[model samples]
Each structure stands twice: as structure tokens, then as C-alpha cells.
Target: MILNGCAIVFDDEKYFSLSGDNVQCDQRYYITNPLTTQFHVKYKKKKEFSPKLLVLMTMSSKDVFDIYVHKGEQ
Candidate 1:
């Protein structure tokens, strides 16, 4: 997770459907911010089950992330 530094807050998309038939495809949630460690990745999609969707993050990284993004208005 970002070269073991970890910091991605949230980049989201999660839709829900399906009433029955036990569902569990992807789920992982962990966030401890003292030293740093963050990961909340999800992956699940169904087409025939009335179209369900969950792809919370798809990151292409260059590594090193402690959380810093305030370059101020360009």
C-alpha cells in the first residue's frame, strides 16, 4: 500500500443489489493512522443478478504516500 506508507483516503463507487443467495466476493478494510496503514479495497460485480457493482479503488502507484495534496488552485 503505497510502498508501505499508505494513504489513499477514498476513491469511491459502490452500488448494491441482490436480495438472497449469499454473496461474498471481495472485502478488505483496514485503517490505522498512527504509524500509517490504510487499505479499503473492494471488488465485486454481477451482470445477471440485476447488475450489481463495487469497485472502490483501482490505483496505479508510483509509491510513497503519507497524504499530501494541496497544491492550491491552479
Candidate 2:
């Protein structure tokens, strides 16, 4: 998903990458909590934000993504 000017690509069940104004030109992030649809983004070790929250607030109500709930460890 692309948010603001950044591109967030979920590589798998555990990895994702961010690239844009705040993010480094080359960097990848690993999901610390994959069970919940929550994650964090840090820029230059200073600025930080939650992409999930941004999506929930900025995205229109018509826009929605499939949500999956995991009961146990994968």
C-alpha cells in the first residue's frame, strides 16, 4: 500500500519496506508483532509514525482491506 508519498510493500508475513521523503532511500522493516495489524515506521532514527493509524484515519471509509485474525502461533 502507498501512503502519502511512501510505498509500503509487505514482503511476507513478517517483512515490509518503506521508501519516500522521511524513509531512507534503502531500508526494510521487520514486523515485531505480526499477529495484530499494527506496525511502526521510523525515519532517520528521529521521526516515527504508525502507518496503520494513518491509514485508518486518512483513508476514506469506502477504502478497506481484508483483515485476518490469527488465533494461535503460526
In terms of lDDT, which candidate is strongest?
A: 1
**lDDT of each residue in 1-74, candidate 1, tens digit only:** 44586544444455544443345553344445634542222334434545343434433345433432222121
Error of 1 at 26 (Å): 19
RMSD of each candidate?
20.9, 19.2
Q: Give each model's clash number.
A: 0, 0
C-alpha local distance difference test of each model: 0.41, 0.38
Flag regions of model 1 displaced more than 4 Å.
1-17, 23-48, 63-74
**Candidate 2 residue runs with Cα over 4 Å from true position:** 1-62
**Per-model TM against the reference:** 0.19, 0.16
Model 1, C-alpha of 22: deviation from truth (Å): 2.7
lDDT of 2 by residue, 4-52 (tens): 6664444223222232434575466666665664434533453353222
Error of 1 at 67 (Å): 16
